[model samples]
Target chain A: MELPGIAFYIVAFLTMGGIYAILCLALNMQWGFGGLFNAGIAGFYAVGAYTAAILTSAGSSAHLGGFDLPIVVGLICAGIASGIVGWAIARICVRLKADYLAMASIGIAEIIRLAIVNEEWLTNGSLGISRIPRPLEAFYSGRAAEVVFVVFVWLIVAVTFLVARRLQQSPWGRVMRAIRDNEETAASIGKDVQRFRTETFVVGSVFMGVAGALSAHYFKFFSPDATEPLLITFLAWVMLIAGGSGNNLGAIAGALAIWAIWSLTEVVTQQLPPDWATRSSYIRMLLIGLLLQFVLQRFRSGLFPEKSPKLRISREK
Target chain B: MIDFINFYLIPGITLGSIYALGAVGVSMIFGILRFAHFAHGDLMTVGAYAALTAVWVLGIPALAAIPFAIIVTCLAALLADRLFYRPLRDLPTIYTVIASFGVALILRSIVQTVWGTDSQVYMTGFQKPTIFFDTFRIATRHIQIILATAALTVALHYFLSRTRLGKSMRAVADDPDLAAVAGLDTERIIRWTWIIGAALAAIAGVFVGLDTDVHTNLGWNLLLPMFAAALLGGIGKPLGAIAGGLIIGIAEEACTYPFFGDTLIAPSYKSAVAFVIMVLILIYRPQGLFRGRLM
Candidate 1:
């Protein structure tokens, strides 16, 4: 490919990877730090994307739209919307076992997808609520626009990464890890384990919502198909797990790596005839699944497992 | 009244039976294996396709292909146990569940690759429902599904409660440490559990193909509902799965009841009903209606 073409594709891929990295960090907060198994990652993501779209889109008047809100307000509200939904889910599912929590999470995601498909008033039905405002699009176009979006997404990713890092080093983060390491012990020591877990879940969901809003603005066009579990939710888990569950930097690395793999697989599989394309994609899915297995078996702590604070402190002494 | 039975009751029972079969397998795995088998639904699809292939290659009828498919699924389950579950035995339950999710994706992709995305029917063309009692009606396939579920349930009950092997299996589920200490072959018992549970999942998938159509996503769509059934029926009790499946199946159909205090709900919302019930059960009755696992 020519330099300009390559540059455009690279910019596009980086923006997507940055957006995914934000999501991975959010998930790490729940699964890694809080020991919560949130399988319904896509539901919170959809909540963010749709909420932002509804708040900002000028064309959507029949439903909850035409507010024409600023992009920042829309983005913040998207986060709030996702967090609220996560809080509700946490109330019902947090007391259950790990397996049950996972089940409820996946169920919530499917329900969200179904609701989006059916509720024309809320989501514009299957046609999907388009015309979501893209930030800074007035000044840039084509390759330039995409490059600006990449910078825009990276700014958000960097901010989220810093906040997540601060949280990881805080006493609150210690309590979170304590709960994950041993819930019984944490409870015995007077920690409100369940409450903290719920908080972590909500906090994590906020970032997911932010990522969703970013994704919506980037594509400027999305349908229910964009929220499919295989493409969005499961991929997030794979990124988090492959990168090192508790490590933020690892999350970023995993996001880029997995996104690369995803796009490359599509490119490789696209060579097939029209009839065989579907089969090839399935084969690609199979490969991705096997890759996850390999990662789980070999890299149990993930590629960049969490650094033990205690170990670091003692070593310094 | 006949319309209610024909539209809701009959379809509910048929769906319930399919779920009951898969739920039994899921519940058994949770009880004995002590992890949620995420791949159970995909395995069901694999079984259906296996049977579909048998019918195609051997030029046999649909019903006749079932046994061969069951055997193949059994072996597949055994292979999965050895290849996936065995390696992660010592890990936490969550890890095993994640592994099962991986297995599910793998199985689904294989089905998509081999069968392509187009929906397939075993007999092609719809079979008209047969009238019963001059007022009630159900398709012939529905009756077969109900009868087959009943037979499987009875046989499973007999084995679990009556035969020595069945008792031993129950004993293992109740207290694996004790069963192991008492000289029972726990590994062999687990192997049998996988074989039986997986064969049952296969039959459920095949029955679905018989009633509706076979597609790559068939089992994926059923995964959550059957899980709800298994959880509702209690963790390990096969009988509970049947009852739970029936309730969930019926509840799903009723979710679209045109009048909801003068409001309307689309039928597309039917699937969410199962999920809502599952969440409620997890909150209010985690031990399940059958009182199996204490969640």
Candidate 2:
């Protein structure tokens, strides 16, 4: 590949890697801090992506789109939309045991998918939406446009990272960890576990939605296929767990590392005989699944384990 | 009324039987293993494909392939437990749940690679439904599936209530620590749970193939309804899961009937029926209809 070609490839890689980093951070908030099992990250993601697509895309007769709003507005609305969904799901399912919550969340994701596919009037069915605007697209074109978008995505990732890090050190984070470590003890200490969980879930879902919107903007199109659970939900879970669940930096590292493995393996798989073409994707999925099992068993805490934030005050006081 | 019975009720029962069979496994696993086996649906897919292979290689009827399917699926379930789930047994149940999600993907991918992604069946041509009393019409496979499920349910009831191993299995599910303290062979009971669960799942897979086509997403698509059935029946209560499965399956098919001059819900959204029912059950009765475990 040429230098520019390789640079362009790197840009594309980082853009997706950044988006996935946001997803991992969002998941870290829920699973890492809150200990809530949200297997429906894809649902919130779809909600956000579709919301942005419907709001910011050019007017179309195929689906619900005519607003042609600003990309910023679309992005904000995406976060809000996903947050609402997360709140509703958490209100009902957050109180359930971890396993039940996982089951319920998967059901919700499936329902969301069914609606997105069947409700053609709203989402254009399987045809998907096109002509989604990229952030500041008018200012750049071609490779420059790609670079600009990657920067935008990384900007969001930086903001997300800062916010997540702040939350991890906050008193709220301490309460969340307390509840996660032992709900009964947290409750005994006068913390409303349910309310805190609901808050954490909603907060996490907002970022997941933002990540989804970023993807929509990156692709300049939106489709149900992009919201696949295996790619979005499962990948994010693997990334967080592999990267180190409780630590913000681990989330980003895991996202980039896993995303690299996910995308680069295609290069090798594409070299196989033509007969193995269709089966290669499945082969990758198998490898990824095995990798998850390996990481869970061998690493357990991931590459970057969580470290408790130290108190600023001295015991002498 | 006859149209309702023929078009709605009979298909509902047929689908419910499949769900019931699959839900039994889910309920038993939940009861004994204390984790939602998300890969259970894929085990059904594995069974369907196994039977498909048997039919292709042996030139035998699909029904005749049940034993092979059961044996293959039983092995698959046992291998997954030993390789993926056993080490995580000491950890929290969520780890196993996540691992099962991975297993679901692995199983689905394996089936896709082996069988190809296209939908297939044991027999391609459609068969005419047998007429009952010159008024009631039912497909032959439906009758067979329903009868087989009924027999299995009866056998399961007897095994749990009468057999020593079955009793020990229930004892472990009820309270693992107590069962262990009581000198029950927890590992042995766990093995039986997997065997029974895998056997029923294989039969259900074959029945689904009989009713429709064997596709990669066949079991994954039915997973929500099966889980709904298990939840409705009460998690851990095998009998309750059967009842739950029947109600969910029937409701899913029947809800689309043109009862009031139009269908209550569009057929395209039939899958949503299961999700709605599951949510309602979660909100109203977490213990399930049979008063199983609270969680």
Q: Number of the top candidate by DockQ? A: 2
Give residue B142's lDDT in candidate 1 (0 to 100): 91
Which one is best on lDDT? 2
Give me the overall lDDT of model 2.
0.91
Question: A242-301 in candidate 1: lDDT tens per residue?
Answer: 999999888988899998998899999899898887688788888888888888888877
lDDT tens readout by residue for model 2, B133-201:
999999898889889989999999999989999888888878889999999988888888999999999
Question: Model 1 residue A241 lDDT?
Answer: 91
Q: Which stretches of candidate 1 lie over 4 Å from their true place?
A: A271-275, A310-317, B257-265
Q: State which candidate has the highest TM-score.
A: 2
- The CAPRI class of candidate 1 is high
Candidate 2 segments exceeding 4 Å error: A313-317
Q: Tell me the TM-score of model 1.
A: 0.96
Clash pairs for candidate 1:
none
Candidate 1, B31-126: lDDT as tens digits = 888888889999899999999999889988677889987998898889888988888888888888988888889888888888888888787766
Where is model 2 chain A poorest over a 10-residue stretch in terms of lDDT? A308-317
Candidate 2 recovers what fraction of true contacts?
Answer: 0.84
